[model samples]
Target: MTHLDDTESDDIGTLLGADGPFARELPNFAPRLAQQAMARAVQQAIAGRDTLIAEAGTGTGKTFAYLVPALLSGERVIISTGTKTLQDQLYFRDLPKVRSVLGARLKTALLKGRANYLCLYRLDQTVREGATFERTQAAQLATIRAWSARTRRGDRMELAEVPEESPLWPRVTSTPENCLGVECPFFEDCHVVKARREALEADVVVVNHHLLFADLALKQEGFGEILPGAAAFILDEAHQIPELAGQFFSQSISARQLTDMAKDVLTECTGITGAIGLLLEPVEALQDALRKLRLALEPLPTRGAFQLLEDRADVRASLHELRELLATLEELLASQAERSRGFANLRERAELFTERLERIVESHGDQDVRWYETFPRGFALYATPLDLAVPMRGLRERTHAAWIHTSATLSVAGNFDHFARQLGLDDPRTLSLGSPFDYARQGLCYLPPDLPDPNARDYTEQVIESVLPVLHASNGRAFLLFTSHRALRRAAELLQDKVPWPLFVQGTAPRPRLLEEFRASGHGVLLGAASFWEGVDVVGEALSVVVIDKLPFAAPDDPVLMARLAALEQSGINPFMGWQVPSAVIALKQGAGRLIRDVHDRGVLVLCDPRLTSKGYGRLFLASLPPMPRTRALADVQVFFANALSPDARDGGEGRAGV
Candidate 1:
């Protein structure tokens, strides 16, 4: 691999400058100083084989900042994004544009987890059991079958006709436990295999954090890793890495996995004579035990530590029965393993589940928190690690590649220590670049006066009442971002008839469709919870007001959080300030970032919680926000919007107030 020398690193600025090839070749291209600085930092990191934690503010064009260096570095690069949507965008849109503008001839491949690709073996199994499906599902299966023939990539993203939540997907897709790998008849033509093969030979591979961490955790041992050895690794939206690392490292077993295994066993029995008669009763008994366990857990809270199960006699009995049933099913499947490949896979799955259940139930180690969360019709058990730093650092050291972590909200109160600690980076090189959007001129932060505590029973109602004037001032082009779904629903109900704009609530429609209609409505008020806080972009005047119901904090009742806080306390750390506050600050930043996406974008941010001024620690949250002018009076908000809409407003006529 060729490294960028000092002279070549210096040229990165000129390459991304106003007179560069990008400006000449790409339309609407504007050179940004912050982006240039970030590109230089990334180039230096890559050339020196160092770890860099970069916090690029919104509008910094962080994608291009890292891309130009990665493309020019002449090294195999792996770019991991926070979501599959961003992964696709980076591969299909951003990478192509940057490569074309730079004239860099390099190969790039898009690789997702096996769940995203269609499995020929599973498709055949589903086809054999077509009559067992409902009419709607059967039709959906037919559509997928038709698509499977012509779709070269077999990526589910290419087929938007079928809803992502359709039950038909799991039937046609393969999981790690069920995949036959090289033993399958369709091994030569397997979509996941073909994609991984292409990725191995490509100069760059685009993947999401789940797949990246899955690889680091060695969760794909059946098929091996898809990410190739790289000279440099760039993780976009790096703030998500800490939490995602914990999830990937955790041991988990879901009721859905057990049910799926049972279904697969039934499907496998279809081809072998007398197999159904022998295995059907064990599968049914396992499913009945699972249902009983879920029912026994209904009286407790939705989520808590494993100790909760020990206190309830009925729950304990149900769990014991479930474990016994799983063991029995494993024994039965072992008898049928020699029948076929499908039976062999089923037996392995049953054994894995049995072992996982026993481990989770028996684990009492302080390093890992054993917990369970019950869903509407299912439940999942997890034994998550108390800290991710050691394992994450281990992975980094094993790679022996330069690591670049960049995100819009990585630092809190201008400090990257919290993020660095989470990923176990000790005294790492860091860069913090402010956005060039001129937030003081383009945006105003409005902290509504005299709101009750966030925990008040009628707090949601008061929040709506406080923001009603701001919503009216902005003419209903706003996003009501809540920390919890309960508040979001309450606010939605309160404003249903009060405001005249088209109300787009989160649960009413798919997120993409809601965003599409919201953008087109011109005066839509969209209300959403956690998922809407980040990864949402609405530029221009279409979204002018962003109302946050409360300071974005993790719920104290969360099982994992409780365990982590306890662990931190034992280590002589103030968990509230050291952990909770910093985490909330990053989350609040992500929510506030939804405003002023572009330089010309103008908006008012209404913070409904009085804690910003009432609490001593609130300063940390306020300090982390962009340098927007702050205001307390609703009249200033009204005037700002009024002036923003006036014909002469382009020259900074909006009102400004100090924090």
Candidate 2:
């Protein structure tokens, strides 16, 4: 726990009240009672050292509500966000404004995942070896080189002109298995180490959930972690914690990882050192084995558990052969004439890979779920734990700090039990605030009728047809969020030439760029998948409608989901009724939340899935949404838009026809 001064100062209400610091500091500030109330509750939670789960609705000024108390509390704090975008916003925008207004000497630092920082050693290695890149990437690498000379933080985001999916990024950045740590030649000038030092000295440290979980994993393993001295913990966008925690708790080893390690070792042998003659044949053999292993995996399904994969004779044989080769390579590296750092790194990686594969093959317990997932490049075998409650509890015990978990959609139908159970929070006080926006006047829920089931082959086409009238009424400032990538692509193709507005697809550019294009175009239809469902905000005129093609539901056949359901069934629970329905309801709530981002913002919510109305569980979805005007007719949607956008309408510029 942080040392407490115990000097009470201005109350949360006074700081956030009308004519308070905000009203005095910012000209556009509006007083929101719900925001003020949430701020007070957060302060109380922090002061009392209690656990709190809060759901502050859209337009609640939730960021300020939490940040104000956090800054004034005088405790060393670690604020974790769900995404990098939000992390940047807090570090760059929100925190500064609050500090200036309060005149508090609050020092803040921003830290990201390891990959976000450049590895001076890796970049030097690439340059020393004269590695070749594709033409476009070569140009980008030149730019990176120019920037590296001037970059103070060595953060990739500093290269704003570089595309997010640039192929050169992975080559320059370091991963856990590849990083040489303190043994690196460039240790003193390490960007990651320097960032950690700065973070530890600051009053507030900002990080994303991935890095935070990495810290937690290290703590669990009794290793050094990155977070500064922290007492209170604030998790914004708390709904994402469950899925992310599942990933961090799992152990994964991919064929591509092995292949990359082999290439790195070979490069070290041939480029940096003069061990090419001794290692060339064995390295080639390892590379061939890895390639054959990738080929063997190509026959399996895109994703499934190792149990299902074991039926493939080719894959099993390849895995066995790869294991044998890894063992032999480890022995061969062990016998190297000079025990160089490169040789030591390769041997360690080889041993770790062998251990992970052995675990994937032999690991079996009610506690762990082993699976394999195939991507465009390669397949990864995972041994993810089915249960996280025990680990979560351990984290809480270790931190010994107040925990405040807050998000816009943490509950389903006013119930936080699902989230609480997943997080293993013990009877935490819960708060659920409806959006301060007048939903009755600011939004309309449109459920189109006579649409085919979501599983139907032509449902994407039907969804297009159903929302055409609304898009026409609103002039195409909308987000068409799909549950699947295939559906999103299909919808994009069907609407390519039909809609009068410019169309933007998710994969055309980075998500931030697509959103910028959407906002800058003034009116465009953005087609996206699950990634667009949450943490996206477009206020006023640029976003007027959110179209969800179907209820967001995880595939039951997913290996992890299957294992979870099996675990629940063993405990005499119905997976769908108890867990699946509530989870979908929470997701549907997040989609609905994309509409009405502010007090006066008016928009329409279009859900094309007939199950939202046809199924018995549909009521659960409806109950989870804000209290608003609900209609099934396209005519009502058209009417709402026409009235909202009409120049004569009273609310025309009062944040109508927008988010």
Off by over 4 Å in 1: 1-6, 221-223, 646-659
Question: Compared to the true structure, candidate 2 yields what TM-score?
Answer: 0.95
TM-score per candidate, chains pooled: 0.96, 0.95
Which run of 10 residues does model 1 get worst, by summed lDDT?
A: 650-659
In model 2, the worst 10-residue window by lDDT is: 1-10
Among residues 3 or more apart in sequence or in different chains, the pairs in candidate 2 whose N, CA or C atoms overlap within 3 Å are none
Candidate 2 — what's its lDDT?
Answer: 0.83
lDDT of 1 by residue, 1-659 (tens): 33566777669999999889988889988899999999999988887889999999998999999999999989998999999999999999999999998889999999898899999988997786656777888789889989999999999999998999898898788889999877899999999999988888899888888998888776563434545368888999999999999989899999999998998888789869999999899889888988999999899899998899888999989989999889988988899899899889889999988899999988877789888999999999999988888888888888888999999999999999999998899778999999988888888999988888888998998888888888888889999999999888888889988999999999998999999999999899999999999999998777989989899889877899998888889899999999999999999999999998987788998888888889999999999999999988888887787665454453354533321
Once superposed on the true structure, which residue ranges of model 2 sit more than 4 Å away at CA? 1-10, 219-228, 271-274, 645-659
lDDT of each: 0.89, 0.83
Error of 2 at 255 (Å): 1.8
True-structure RMSD, every candidate:
2.7, 2.8
Report the C-alpha displacement of residue 361, candidate 2, in angstroms: 1.5
